[model samples]
Target: MSHVSGDLVRRYANGDKGIPADQVWALEAHMETCASCRQLLASHADGIAPLLDTVWAGLTPAEVPAKRRRLSTWITPAGFPWIGMTILIAAIAMLLDALTVLDTSFVLLVAPVAPMLGVALAWNKNADPMYELVAGSPRAGLELVLRRTVGVLVVMIPALFLAGLPGRVSPALWLLPSLAFTVGALVLGLLIGVTRASVVLAGVWLLVVAGPSLAEQNVPAVLHPASLPYWALIIVGCVAVLGLRADSFSRLLR
Candidate 1:
């Protein structure tokens, strides 16, 4: 496993607040999953031992418990609003479908990209105010990314299912595509960052599928049953790429 530099750990443990925030964030994030680095941090902690003891003594049992309840590693509070927005968008699409406002399947068009918005927000630095702390947690790498992705899927899949109930679109048409796009975002995210990757994928979907479908007043051929195998292939390929680049998620910038 990659480890933090010894000099950086020593500076951090010596209470050197002058360290750049990005470097600090990276170090903390790396140490969370690296036992050897954690040990290195402990070795350098003697310099700050007295301060730690004093602070520890100042905290009362009641005050300790008064801290906010720990959130699940699967999802952060920052992701909740985006998830709700995604559900709202699905509901709106369903409404449009029910009212026959659009000739094409609006529900199907929206379903595949719905969960992606939430996945983008899941670990985004700009979206999550507590990103530093979250990144510094023990679950900061691909495990954390997968957990948050699962969390997004858990809420979005049900919402999409209910939304599609009012439309003629079959779940498989949208479901496989949704999973494919979500995992594809992660695969691309290893290089470009999750938020940008998601935006690019969504934009491409709108241009290639949703736009043409609406203009033709018909669901695109890609959303047809025959295309399910292609979507499945994309998902499998993205999953394999994600597995190979798993370590990329440990960095602060991503």
Candidate 2:
């Protein structure tokens, strides 16, 4: 691969706005794979060393500890509450199922979208206070998004599994749909924001599947064993698209 020109590296390191967006993107993307170019960029970035030092100098000794409590890049603090809420909702659904309060299995109905609550907040601009700084970083594209999404799934998948135990539903019935919706949100998020994409997909599922399933007191065909393959196909397709458009998340607009 051709290395980026020194002038472009200097301008990028200096935060020059005159450079076109595409060039800036290409340069950053290239730097991720090119150690020599990254070293060159680091050298150019030395010009900002004094500014950084000045900012650090302005901080008082008393305030240093507070500043050190930096947020995790994988998942925002706001995501915890949403994750908690999802778990609580799943428990409630399980309770409803055990009590025979609803003819349709509430556990299965809620399983697919349970992780969505956490996923939506995973990279939400509003939920994350450090959105600008995090999104502007060189590694802030698909990798960061996937990290946060995995963090959510790690917690949610087990919770959903246990919650559905009482309903005796096949794991595939809920697991595949959950995976599909989660990745589908990310795929659509390349066009809309993740938060909006999550909401839109969840809303559609509730309307088209959950609502009808509850109203008719029957499990939706989409959630049946026969539909697992289709859900798997959707997941594969969404993942492929996400890989192709991975750069989209790096933009501030996303």
Candidate 3:
């Protein structure tokens, strides 16, 4: 049996758990000569597992969006390109409704533009010349734009409801008009880009879609397929791609 005067060596080798003070010096001397034991200790190192990995019961999943996109974000932002203007327009609409200058219902028009133009200009700005070459490229453009449109809508929706609350317009009336108007603006914005070159985007859209649609006081005329609601609804249908996967944009860029 190994024996030692140093307490440390006695403790380590014989399970003494304690040893004389003189044995401490003997233990140090033994350790200096023991290359094998030193290497064994080094291999054990700190003997600790990484807390984050080892303690976790399971790994968290990764996904493109952690949460479903909020429609509110699209509401107000879609109505205007500039955040300031987007914010400003919603504020003005609310104010106009409050002061009796305009119907609280005007908030509807402001909501859609944030999404339509906001998405359009953003897509146009980022547009690689190659976007048009591939099939389904427009879908990608639509998704990116639509996501942005949703952001605008999110803010505008609440502002709209609050603005109308004071005016005694039923909530349903405000919401339907906003929805109808958003549908209208989105279509008008997309279509007028094809029409008069002399006109700016919004001005042309305003003259063609908003002006005409509102002029048709009859709900049936407003809903007419040749008119704003029809076109707006169609454009909204096209923009439904927002909720879909973005693989199309990647392919289009390719």
Candidate 4:
């Protein structure tokens, strides 16, 4: 790397992202192959992490809320996967109708499609046209999580209500799966930076939860029953995961 490039990496490592981004991008490109430069970037991250924590902690509620909203600026990018999610949701909705699953119960899955896709599209930086904006801010992680989660919920709930009009599963009941999947996968995404672990965990969680249900095995009634405490625990666990690690958790939006 050139001398200028070395200096920029130092600034970035020191968490001085104020450097014109082009300068930093050059360093990141070079650092991709250069271990010494990567080491520097890691050092910068160490300093930046603590500083970000302080910025996050001292954030006023008002500031936090606005910052979260700012992350909503991007629409999910258009792509095959999103089209697939939409098609899957639509197919499920149509199947519910044909099967005459509770008029309303079947359709609930329909609403969340757009929002889910939208957020997914936004977080997907692969074809992202907004890297500059996303790259500029550390808070992008938190905002990214909040935007997609909130956006999908806004669409998913309404569509579900519309599609499942008959006395199908209670919206309250179905809402659990949607919310749980979002937070759970989102959490895993943040930690692993990939959907594989989250997807695996989800499959396992489903087996544990729905498998017992589908098998309809005889169980001690008390052990089998899903009590209020169970729901409370579920909620508490999800909330803790979201709240305690908003920074790290938000990174999962990727």
Candidate 5:
């Protein structure tokens, strides 16, 4: 195969002249096998050379986004299934309470802790396939965490309301505790893994609060009206810790 003329390559590179279609095709094909001619073309490109390089540079992997097609800047597709499962569990708990199969006290026992599981799932590496992408985003960490947490509560609190209807469990009984537990889990999550932190808190609630409440058929003291002030204090304190440690969420464990 013959090499492209220096004149043709320069013309093509610089938009100085338009070559005939047939010759342009042959010249391009020839350049594929002719590194010397390719170099010669680039040398003749002059002022247009840098523009060509810039265009090519933009096509490289380095120029591409680290992550792609994330569902939202904050939440990911991985969160949906977990949130749905949490709601389903809440609905089942409601049904059980309605049937009186589990005592109303037992229903109340799990209500505050149920949403924490969803929050854990929202950001946990094990639960989210895109955890790295979600957590490493520029808007990751506290802002992203808070958005997903809000999503969990938006879906969860309403479900709890419907479920608690049959049991006559007051919203006041569970709401502040739910928020407090979620914030506390997040605060602890900054040190330990979020999944582990949430699991630990939930397990503690089950063993210390739920089990005893169920066995004795009474509301746990923590869920009582007089305890509301302490829950409020927990909420304020955890929020401050979360804000202080916001950057930690951006660099989550792989």
Candidate 6:
């Protein structure tokens, strides 16, 4: 039942003005644990009332039809299907390896680019229903893109690792290339759309690496241990480029 003094709460809510630092901190700390004091502070925030009204009025009708959801609400529904598909692909690849249906390790061949597929969907204007709304925010762009990419990766990397486990696939065989390819997609996405960039990278890999490697029954040179240092360099270079060009993603093409 204890509370910050009404006068202090009112002064704190109205404006810091001449309030002492210790008093301000005390008021804030009390407000954190006191709902009645919070209400008192809100009541004192007369100047903010009109602004709050304006913001409430601007809420879309679509937003009011249901109870506000959790942080999961922020993730677009479009991403779920794509994430599922990415998981299914990993599962199927593992199954194929288990059955020995393929002459080569199908899992390794796809692992590098598999996660990017979901990453592409994570921010694709075509896939995300709220892309315009989300993309238009000032906090959008590379920061948001990287966050979503990380989210996709969180689900993907483990799945890929699990798939590769039974086959004894070396993490180096797929992990480095995966980072390199993901960074490549991100860098390319700044120029083109992320989805298109993913398609281009996947297509090129299929045409130039996967298809040939399969036909010749040889592991691609890029995925070989001798080539790992090269892949490491590529990953480093690409990440540096991404950091330098991070600003470009802010004004990314729709």
TM-score of each: 0.73, 0.71, 0.40, 0.49, 0.72, 0.70
The lDDT per prediction is: 0.86, 0.86, 0.46, 0.53, 0.81, 0.82
User: Looking at model 2, how many pairs of residues clash?
Assistant: 0
Tell me the tens digit of each residue's lDDT in model 6 across 105-166: 88899899998888887568787777778777898777777877788888889999999898
lDDT per residue, candidate 3, 65-126, as tens digits? Answer: 66775654332222344544556666786676576554224554444443333334333323
- Scored by TM-score, the top model is 1
For candidate 1, the TM-score is 0.73
Q: Write the per-residue lDDT of candidate 1 for residues 93-133, one digit (tens) a residue.
A: 99998987776778899999989888998668888887788
lDDT of 2: 0.86
Show the colliding residue pairs in model 1: none
Model 5 TM: 0.72
Query: Which residue window of length 10 is worst by lDDT in model 2?
Result: 60-69
Ranking by TM-score: 1, 5, 2, 6, 4, 3
Q: Which run of 10 residues does model 3 get worst, by summed lDDT?
A: 190-199
Per-residue error at 75 for model 2, in Å?
Answer: 2.7
Candidate 3 similarity to native, TM-score? 0.40
For 74-164, candidate 2 gives per-residue lDDT tens digits of 6666788888989999999988889986657898998898887789877788888878897899878888889999999999999988988
RMSD of 2: 15.5
Which parts of model 6 are misplaced by more than 4 Å? 1-68, 73-77, 101-103
Candidate 4, 120-164: lDDT as tens digits: 444444545665466456757656657655755665566556555
